[model samples]
Target: MAGSSHYIMPRAEFDDAPKLLIVISPYYKDIADNLLAGAKAEIEAAGGTHEVIEVPGALEIPTAIGIAERMSNFDGYVALGCVIRGETTHYETVCNDSSRAIQLLGLQGLCIGNGILTVETQKQAEVRADVNDQNKGGGAAAAALHLIALARKWSVARKGVGFTNDILMAGKTDGSSTA
Candidate 1:
């Protein structure tokens, strides 16, 4: 079944002060390569350093992310994978399980980006894998950065900073303000 898209949050400006780890599944080598390239470009544009790790398939992405979180070196993570549906129930299992795992990671404040493409066919996967355009990898990197930014803001707010005028001014200067 095609998933609903209305749940996507509006994009937010990302803070560039944190290191990132990107884990990609190499099952579909070409698509994974494009995703890696897209993620690298976006991270560089945001002035952040990123390290890439490759796993065997989408099933291994969440475990890799969990391990990275425990290491405590990265401020965020981006997961890239391509799981094209075939003529078997295996497609549903992979898609659902991977999506749920990523959501669980985010709920636990892991700052994980989901760039996994669950498509019905190889052609659709290719269409979504365009590194320079319609790249889910770019979207995933943006999501990870957005989560990190929000987490940092929440921490500062909890410290009695109170989201003051000075903080607002700083955000404006850095183009972090929405309006």
Candidate 2:
């Protein structure tokens, strides 16, 4: 029996379709391909657009996103990768550090969905990445879309006191204007 039931969120509609960047670590190319398929499907279904870039490994995913944030025009980011637990403690370091970095970036007010799978075995990753199964890649893309919607909802171009031309001119002369 499956450990869980299928669950999917309602489809989202957007006024201003988001332009997204998908940063994937092609450490496992096959898994990455599956992930990309799912992510692309979700992005297209939502009427959003995305571009994919690959880094060497999971460790580089966040750094790539950070760089893209400063250098690219994407409204949101989807981080996709898989890190199968290994015999060495390196797995933990990679898992923890990458996840932490992604979270930190999100807290910095970037829209990001982290889809790095830190699993005990390849089988686990396959199950999660399967399009008919967990479909974590699509979920991550959906997550980014939701966050982008929220960001658009609460976006602040500017927030402060306002003044008309007359008020500004009068204030410049008298240094006080109730207008």
Candidate 3:
């Protein structure tokens, strides 16, 4: 006789333990507002405090994030904006530069969430900005939380802390266990 094996999933328990900063562009007011609201709700649900900062436009998100990262007060950041393709190549430049800067911030161990929506038309942007559904804002906050969780985990692991029960127990006695 054999019994089925059961497995447990590890849950990220970062509730009420982190702070987040959200930067929004005023270029597309309506869409930006929706994104901000969604991101704020998600951050609060995750047990985190959040603050919103308005930038001139999507092009300024990276700079704002950079300043936030340098401050090191918040654990993570979420950038919200809407960039719709127009008659020129301005869209490409904004999208690429903002993305690159965010990535760079992440590489430097800063948890940055990108909520900027790049679309071909206003309609497409509207669909994603809908607060009822398809909310990119929530997605960005989730991303920030995820990155912070991973960074914390990695930091602990680097210090020779294992996720195993035995190691955790030993660490507890040594006051070196984190979780």
Candidate 4:
């Protein structure tokens, strides 16, 4: 049942080419490599350029993206990592906190694709990270590209910051009543 289901991903197109920052936590070197390969392929397929950065662990991925958003000019971000369940509750903490932070950042209007894999074992993570199989990294990139396209589509040019010309012409700039 794993590979039986399919999702209809939105077509990732943009009027202007987008630049994406891929932040990865490479605790598992092989899995990270596969995820990065898939993400790169997807971004390139959509005519977008990307830069990859490595963080220490899954918990750091969101922080890296947040810093990049404030300091750099990337149009979007892709977060990639794998957290396998262990004997202790550290796995739960990492998975929950990392995912929550990513979600909060997304809510703040950042075009972010979350590719972090939380699984019971390394085998499960391998299957999901494999480009030939689930290709979650590619899926995440596509998701980010879609968001960027949407933002571009709905974006409107700002004429000015203050009130409109009509409001100014009315001579009612302040809340005080003339009467």
What tens digits encode model 4's per-residue C-alpha lDDT throughout 68-145? 999999999999999999999999999999999999999999999999999999999999999998898998899999
Off by over 4 Å in 1: 1-16, 160-179
C-alpha lDDT (0 to 100) for residue 146 of candidate 3? 81
lDDT of 2 by residue, 1-179 (tens): 65767667786679878999999998998899888888999999999999999999999999999999999899999999999988899999999999999999999999998889899999999988988888999999999998998888766543333755665666376666565
Task: Give TM-scores for every candidate, taking all chains together and pairing residue i with residue i.
Answer: 0.80, 0.85, 0.79, 0.86
- Among the numbered candidates, top TM-score falls to 4
Ranking by TM-score: 4, 2, 1, 3
* Worst-scoring 10-residue span by lDDT in model 4: 153-162
CA lDDT for candidate 4: 0.91
Model 4: pairs clashing at backbone N, Cα or C within 3 Å: none
Best by lDDT: 4
The backbone clash count of each candidate, in order, is: 0, 0, 1, 0
User: lDDT-based ranking, best first?
Assistant: 4, 2, 1, 3
- lDDT over C-alpha atoms for residue 152 of model 1: 82
